[model samples]
Target: MNTGEKDWDKKGWKDVPIAGLITEPGTARRYKTGEWRTHRPVWDPEKCINCLLCWIYCPDSAIQVKDGKVVGIDLEHCKGCGICAHECPSKVRAINMVLESEAEAEDGEKVKEETMREGEEGEKERKEERKGEGGNEK
Candidate 1:
């Protein structure tokens, strides 16, 4: 097939690298844009109906999925565009767009709660071990 060739450099344009240009496939993954987000989407696992609309509509592909269900939101690449929350069904209301600071506070609370629960469990286990040791000795 004879194809007409046009001059790509007719305007003296050089093939120089530019920021945010997709010169190579899958290059966008290297650049994390999550820092640019002002708000973050918080997913409520109990309220989610596995609609997958958020996964489909998310521009950042941050919705994590497993076994045909949404597992969580990947904050590493999530741009906090709120598209996932917006795409979520109104009745489900599983995804909520919260301020970054508020989300941080919520996350910190969760971590604290988890630590407390672990401490309690550890204490209970130690008490049980002590009782077993003391009963056998006596």
Candidate 2:
């Protein structure tokens, strides 16, 4: 018996070919592992100090650095590992892990509130202008 075949059978047929084994190396790029994430990282630009710690600690290399500053997080490749948020300096704490559903809801509410506030302010300005015109006409 050939030593190679004998060893393979002795291993309990573990050497059998896997159906979808990655024959081509470096093909992991085609897989988007972000879909597995239950929570997502949200970046608060106002609180970020551009320290680059998040960029350095990200295991998936999802942090986008531009002009020597962290511009944003790349969600496509981010696995929601929370490394960036956890590694962020305590002083800045610019990155936060939020539930995916909560993030969406919060964003919608923010836009609605901003729109209502702007409309109210515009109405106040128009009223002030009308009063000034009445005084001038008299």
Candidate 3:
């Protein structure tokens, strides 16, 4: 008898099925060290079926459910892999992945540009006031 045969004593499956996919025999796959997250998951409660697959499949524990609604990522702990987006099985797809690049952040380059513009406007106004005062003194 083959030792690999399934034992009936084990619960559930009688035997493990063979996998169809196989890695290259002598190739080493390299992975990125740091957490990878280009996008975050956004949920729409109206469309959510509350199946909880997103919460269960998340390796990072990023998905949360509160008050019967689904929420994604703590940000402090979430490393977005789009796993939640992929796992969500609703026909309408309630969850969406949003990019979190520097351009998307609150204090990003666009905000800096707006602040600089405001500062320049203020400086111009101050210069005009000074010119008007000098003319009054003349």
Candidate 4:
């Protein structure tokens, strides 16, 4: 048969009669537009008021908190909808919608801060260890 020809009565391909019956599982599906914003929301804990608006408003449930503070975003599943940033109540804006490129720039800044914090903690631990060694002067 030619590719353009229609086989109306091909055994398994034949149309089956349905008495207006619906028998399909409700699967978790995403309404995709095939287009998405490049900007994603990022949280600044220091500026966050712990209002939880960001978490509540996130359509993707991509935001989470810890110790009553917004801590992280699961970027893997985030489609950068910016709904959380739009819902954030902070005047100074703890949550901000940033372009994918701009977010990368900010990620670099955060990495620097994390490295500093780690370095400080390591230094504090070393000081405590030295103090435990009888405040060794040698």
Which structure among the candidates has the greatest TM-score? 1
Q: Give the TM-score of candidate 1.
A: 0.58
**lDDT of candidate 3 at residue 6, scale 0 to 100:** 39
Q: If the candidates were sorted by their TM-score against the true structure, best first, what order would they fall in?
A: 1, 2, 4, 3
Candidate 2 local Cα displacement, residue 47, angstroms: 1.4
TM-score of each candidate structure, all chains considered together: 0.58, 0.57, 0.44, 0.48
- Tens digits of per-residue lDDT, candidate 1, 57-84, equal 9986678776789877766568899999
Query: Residue by residue across 59-109, what tens digits does model 3's lDDT show?
Result: 855565556566434443356677778889958687777776642484567
Query: CA lDDT, every prediction?
Result: 0.68, 0.67, 0.54, 0.58
Higher-scoring candidate on lDDT, 1 or 2: 1
Better of 2 and 3 by lDDT: 2
What is the alpha-carbon lDDT of model 1 when measured against the actual structure?
Answer: 0.68
Q: How far is candidate 4 from the true structure (C-alpha RMSD, Å)?
A: 19.7
**Pairs that clash in candidate 1:** none
| Residue pairs clashing, model 2 | none
How far does residue 53 in candidate 1 sit from its true spot (Å)?
A: 0.4
Estimate, for each residue in 1-138, the C-alpha lDDT of model 4 and write its tens digit.
222233334333234436533343321122222125488667787887888887888776556555666666655446788778888874858878778777667677785466456444544544554453331110
Per-residue lDDT over 58-116 for candidate 2, one digit per residue giving the tens place of the 0 to 100 score: 99777767678876666645778999999998989999999866765777777446534
Q: In candidate 2, how many Å is residue 37 off?
A: 0.8
For model 3, the stretches where C-alpha displacement exceeds 4 angstroms are: 1-36, 102-138
